[model samples]
Target: MLDLAWRPRAHLDRESIAIHLGLERKAPQAALDAMRRIDDAIERVRTFPDSGGRVRLDALRRTEYRTVLANPYTVYYRFDEKTLTVYRILHQCQNIDTYALVDLPR
Candidate 1:
């Protein structure tokens, strides 16, 4: 089993989602669901990113930050060996870097 732990970056994701919720009614369900799928995807990705099963972020330099989109929303997750961290959750148009936090050994 994967040992998952979310860092401060995850909170940024929550805040991003909140912003969307405030702007519209019915909440960001599609985004929320995408995040959930991402959580599940992390396990497999943790095992392998080149599995052709998940979308990998190629613009972030040498980072593991990647997102899976559900319509206008994007679910962001980070994988660290045994831990698959559910970091950021946001819409496709959201400024992804604004929520970006580099990883350091904890």
Candidate 2:
């Protein structure tokens, strides 16, 4: 298995989701469940790096951008021989191509 790494935006995104669900929506249990699901998706990706579906964005087509769905959210990542780098964790309703792909290293 490749080593796992998280980009800063990925961390912030996860934290923001937790805050929004737990504090803003007053759904602390839901927040925890969401977090667990995200973690589970990450683990699944770690075990099978190519298991995620390839992202279908024109600009990202040349690169191996992939996503693992976690119900209402998605985990976006790119993997090399030695590492799997998480780029972002975003809500399913968001325009991921516009939001997550920006500022990512090609």
Candidate 3:
């Protein structure tokens, strides 16, 4: 069987989710639903990053050390032969550049 890995960025992504959940004015059900979608999306990538290089999640794209879904947030990572190293997570709304996320350790 193939191995699965998550870049450290996934941790930050989870933290970001926590913050979103903490928002006081949002509907609980809708927040939970979105969280579930985000969680499911990441897990889906773990199970199948590509079907021979075609993405399991068609909505994401690879950047230098990061992967961006349709805005809102991004996932940074590095892929080795058998493992993926997550670097950091950020909200696209931050108005920052890639270097801002470089502070994350491998």
Candidate 4:
């Protein structure tokens, strides 16, 4: 099985979604559904690394990130041979070009 590692930003993204949808919007069920979708997408990526669209960042020299969509959310991840690192989870409205990849430990 491929290893899964999550960056801090990804965790924050999930938390933000839960708060915005469940607490702020008062839609617990929808929040749950969204989380489930994100989880499922992550599973798919872990099982099949190439499942997402490959995103090549000019700034990152050695790593290539892939993007997977879970409806309104976009999951950014990178596979470094043995481990899959989930870099960020962003809402669809966010500017994708602003993301800067940093070296993550395996």
**Model 3 per-residue lDDT tens digits across residues 1-106:** 2254554556766666756765754666755765665555455545554412322332333443435352355555445456655455556565445454454465
TM-score of 1: 0.52
Cα lDDT of all candidates, in order? 0.57, 0.89, 0.51, 0.83
Alpha-carbon RMSD of each model: 4.7, 2.3, 5.9, 2.9
Least accurate stretch of 10 residues (summed lDDT) in model 2?
A: 97-106
The reply for model 4, stretches above 4 Å from the true place, is: 56-63, 100-106
Per-candidate TM-score against the hidden true structure = 0.52, 0.91, 0.54, 0.84
**Candidate 1: misplaced stretches above 4 Å?**
15-59, 102-106
Q: Mark the 10 consecutive residues where model 4 has the least summed lDDT.
A: 97-106
How many residue pairs clash in all the candidates, one count each?
A: 1, 0, 5, 0
Model 3, residue pairs in steric clash: 7-85, 7-86, 8-86, 9-86, 9-87
Scored by lDDT, the top model is 2
lDDT tens digits, residue span 17-63, model 1: 65555445456775566556655555565566434224344566466
Q: Quantify how close model 3 is to the true structure by its C-alpha RMSD in Å.
A: 5.9
Error of 3 at 22 (Å): 3.4
User: Which candidate would rank higher by lDDT, 1 or 2?
Assistant: 2
